[model samples]
Target: MSRILVVDDERNVLTSFQHLLGKKGHEVLTAKSGEQALSLLGSNSPDLILMDIRMAGLSGLETFRQAKAIVPKVPVIMMTAYGTTDTAIEAMKLGAFEYTLKPFDIPKLTALIERALAMGQLMRTPVTYGAADADARAQRIIGKSSKMIEVYKLIGQVAPSNVTVLIRGESGTGKELVARAIYHHSQRAERPFIAVNCAAIPETLLESELFGYEKGAFTGAVARKPGKFEQASGGTILLDEVGDMSPSTQAKVLRVLQEGTCERLGGHETIRVDVRLLAATNQDLEALIRDRRFREDLYYRLHVVTITVPSLRERKEDIPLLAEYFLKRYSRELQKSGMRLSPEALERLSAYEWPGNVRELENCIKQAMVLGQGDVLMPEHLRLGQSSAVQLRSAPESLNAVRELARQHLEQAPGSAHQHLIEQVEAQLILEALMQTQGNLAQAAKLLGITRPTLREKISKYRIQRRVHLNQREG
Candidate 1:
């Protein structure tokens, strides 16, 4: 049994933690605020501290800094109710033992506690790459598929270091999620996690957004701003969609990454920043690098730790659990109590091809939940495009034919410019998801969490109408 400290401003939460740990046969301590928690840590230090991020006086992050001063070896687990991208990332950067969202699974938490204790026991042993303090991982990525298992093993090997990580995969393959998982599992899991999407902001403003600007640096620069890098000092920064960044901006990014510092767009001071870099992209960066679009040096820097997320279709076995997860999430979001997927609906979803990946899958379920009139989701309510019945039947049953069919499906149909761009993105996502899922719809949807009807809609919407035929050997 390990001694645990539960810190929170809310009395109910503190009590809940005490009860949970006590029931698990562990000695537990409770603190109402950061000040109280530190005082308790003066002489009696618990093996682990589970602290709430938001509090009345000194915040959890502040308390974490102080507690580590007393016992540098003791691990801290940060919990947050508000699942903001920045906060979650920040906690992970700060060397937190783990970052658990509110309303987390009890069983998962129990397992995590055991792992932490196990890791504590193993600390005396020399830690190494792919084998360092594996028990300290914030979240256990549970998967048995060859690809997913490889990803886990790789992360365990790299998580404790300060290496720059580049996560590549199709959109909805959880590239950023994988980066966050890495941050939390690393030695810097207790610092800050700051992320910026390179594609969302306009090109003209991206430079200022990343390097920050002085109060009057630009016409609309009313107040001095700190960039993501500055905010993420002593932690990690996830440069998402790195492939979309402009050449000019990419050069600047490369400089900061290589030199470990940056100067604001108009500022003179070369402010130094110590941060671990994590980059993600759905585009073919190697091609971009070859074309001189992305800097080769920067590419190599971020490539220090490369991870590819498995598409949903690739892991068919995880679909049922994923479906259940999304159903519960959508149910709570829509205020529909005890909503579920019917057995037939589940079976149908398992049969369809999800081109949109996980993001599309979640959207389909949300739309279905809203359109659904009952507690259960139905095939019709999903609005997925399943107009590929003809194409599927006509497909040839050869390896070469399957690849050719997939390729033809991605080839653009005749369309106007606006439709063409949408079609292009849609085609790309579908193809990538299919590749990752290994041509399995159930796994793809679960990977994407889309209903059969909805994924069917996109396949038709993009006119991915190439026919395919598979032998008994094909999955």
Candidate 2:
């Protein structure tokens, strides 16, 4: 049975429809005003909304408009006792699924509701609904950080034009997110946004992937195929990891950018594609150009609108919000209730250096959510420091302080070296993990997913032996 929400100011009409729909085996909810309906919507999304045309406070038409704003795809059937041509026309114009005059045929209304439900199910999936806020409809950027705000501004400024965008960032820093943000917010938002990773594909296949190929283009070419450019005509194409692309492919890409035209491999016909190109690279493209690995002309072409995504370390302030967001997101999926991070745990997270950036932070949070025993997440829930057998020994004011401590101890020690750089970092990580695990090394190693010996090597390397001896002597 489909879920339906009925909104009307009349108690009698609401009772009659609720009884009728309930007996027909459909689950029904009732709301007297738009505010109540909105509250209901926040909890659960109904398949269809059956609204009376006139109501008190907020009119049915205004309610319907608000409903569309919240959940654009839900089908709404407007009902009115006093039917007029203008009302019907206005309802249709505003995308109402159907219009019914009050005291009307109940059977016809039921059929229309069923049809609207079926149509809604076929048109869009709920997962795709409200994927982001309404403001993000034009851009897929999911951030409120100052860095991302600047990225959003750049998107708005360059979206209307056919400017090539070069997005630079560290690996897993969400370069593609920025690229998608640009594509979805641009004039080509309605069109397909195709992304091709330059490094993943083989050199030979990269050309054929960007430009179409004739049936006889190469020995393996059995049928004609369209390239990324052709498929993205009048749309946007993202060349991800562009710095890793082969020099030969770089030359081909340069031609497409300069001429807006390409010839299929082994095909004489020249095809033109009006595609806006967006390129992304973690590597410095200028350095690649200087090394003769990337074409300078191509670099200039793709750098028309540059957007640089800051590493997670640069925006540590966003960690708490991002952690909460992911906590809620994964908690809902896992059906776990009352999940939240402790302030201490969040502080520990914010102090660390996220080498892997957002991707690493997301993974850490996901792991923590799975390990958390109660509503609140503690430092032990995260296995970050344990990954490399490194145990951070101090709660420093900054990442730089931690690094400085590690360097000072390494450089100033006059005895047999206490630890190598890697060993110290690893020992620090392991110590933090052990503290979180309540001194359970086996579980800590398991959390780190390493054999006890490897963990032991890190412990011995860090010269924690003297500390253990001192504890034994004191005991």
User: Candidate 2's residue-wise lDDT over 1-475, tens digit each?
Assistant: 6789999888898899888887655789999987788889988899899888777888777788788777765778888774453464365445566667777787688788877886555333211111344432132334677886786777678877889989899886878767766665567665546678888988878989788677678997755556768766777788999998888788878888999888878888878778899999889888877888888888888897798988988888778867876776666545456788888898889998987777777768866865578888898888775432122333345556767877687677745345455566677777765665555545455456554555666666676544432111100
Model 1 lDDT-worst window of ten: 466-475
**Largest TM-score belongs to which candidate?**
2
Q: All models: lDDT? A: 0.69, 0.72
Could you give me the TM-score of model 1 versus the true structure? 0.53
For each candidate, give its TM-score against the true structure: 0.53, 0.55
lDDT of 1 by residue, 1-475 (tens): 5799989999998888888887665789999999999999997878888888888999888888888787655667777774442453355445565666687688788777775665443332222222323454222343456787788787777788898888988776667667777776788765656567899988999988788777578897644556767756787788899999998888878887778878887789888889888899989998998898888877887798789987767776655655665676555435666878888777777776665555556666765665467787777766554322233334466556656545565574433545555566667777655555555554444435444445566666666545321111212
Candidate 1, superposed: residue stretches over 4 Å from native: 1-143, 333-337, 373-376, 385-475
